[model samples]
Target: MDIDLKELNLDELKSLQKQVVKAIGDFEQRKRDEALNAAKAIASEHGYNLEDLMGDGPTKKSKSKAAPKYAHRENPALSWTGRGRKPAWVIEHLESGKSLDELLIK
Candidate 1:
């Protein structure tokens, strides 16, 4: 479509620009949706889902919750898996000249 930019006022130009940006974004999204749908259909035909074929998709496997390796001496409810940064309780225990082995969930 031919559009004479020189003929359009400032407001009209701004409106046109907004419309063009929206149209471009919508076009890209539509293309992605179409491609995904097509891929899903193809995967279905092969007795598999799009996620099953693409292991990194929305239905990808997630790491199971790690079991707690240690628990609070006073309150057994407070526990840690010994994975990431130590919790306040664990830090406090260590600060009080206590060993991490003391917190081990026997």
Candidate 2:
């Protein structure tokens, strides 16, 4: 469609800008829905359910901290998850000829 842009004033231009933005958003949603529906139809024809075909599957990984696998015998508050490098106290204890097994939290 051909239109005269120069004839429109500021208010009309602003309104047209909003309409264009809304139209673009609506167009994108329509296209996404169309593609998803087509994919679901094809999956069903192949005897697969939609979730079996395209779902992300599984909940996100938990954020909870792992149980402390090691701790200082002298200070129960000092602990380590046993994942990263050994802490300074742990290193010193090991250097003193005491086995790491002795520092196990359990």
Candidate 3:
């Protein structure tokens, strides 16, 4: 419809702006609902459920790459195996200023 913009004041213009934003939001919500309904209908026609379609399937394991369980565990290659605090031999070598790499097993 044709309207005279000159007759509207700043307050009216602000109100119109708010109304336009609200209308756009409502339209987007309606569109999303329509799309969801269409998807549901398609899923039903195909005998597939939404939950199953979106859920983790039998072959789909977790996407997360878990950290190695024993990554932080003691290095088995070390002489002491690093199970506890440094062993007596390790301490002795350290006190002598000897490198553990030279003394300890590789």
Candidate 4:
């Protein structure tokens, strides 16, 4: 684990620094993933998903699933959950002067 940094030239030092940064980032990711997997195993043993414990992880955000709000007229199967971004079909219909009410599932 001991590095003779004194023998390293400026360019070599810079390259080593970059490598060190990348190694640190990779190590951190591995550690986080390992810890998460361990936590998930413990949670599963207790009959709960990791998400159930963290409520969508360390961020503690929860998203309730919403019913579909928009349906493609030509293709009924094509639908949008209306949670995040609007779908292209919805945008197209809107641009073509169709109202959201027109595509309502009701």
- Identify the runs in model 3 with alpha carbons over 4 angstroms from their true place: 56-106
Query: Per-residue lDDT tens digits of candidate 1, residues 1-106?
Result: 8989999999999999999999999999999999999999999999988886778666646889999999999999999999999999999999999999999988
Q: State candidate 3's TM-score.
A: 0.51
lDDT tens digits, residues 52-85, model 4? 6777755645977888988888999999877788
Candidate 3, residues 1-106: lDDT per residue as tens digits? Answer: 7767789999998998899899999999999999988988898899987667877445556666533222111454434444557766568667888666655342
For candidate 4, report its TM-score: 0.49
Model 2, residue 106: C-alpha shift (Å): 26
| Model 2 weakest lDDT span, ten residues long | 52-61
Best by lDDT: 1
- Better candidate by lDDT, 2 or 4: 2
Sort by lDDT, best first. 1, 2, 4, 3
Cα lDDT for residue 89, model 4?
88
Model 1 stretches with alpha carbons more than 4 Å out: 56-106
The residue ranges of model 2 lying beyond 4 angstroms of the native Cα positions read 55-106
State the lDDT of candidate 2 residue by residue for 1-106, as single tens digits: 8768899999999999999999999999999999999988998899987875555644467789889999999899999999889999999999999999999976
Per-residue lDDT for 77 in model 1? Answer: 92
Better of 1 and 4 by lDDT: 1
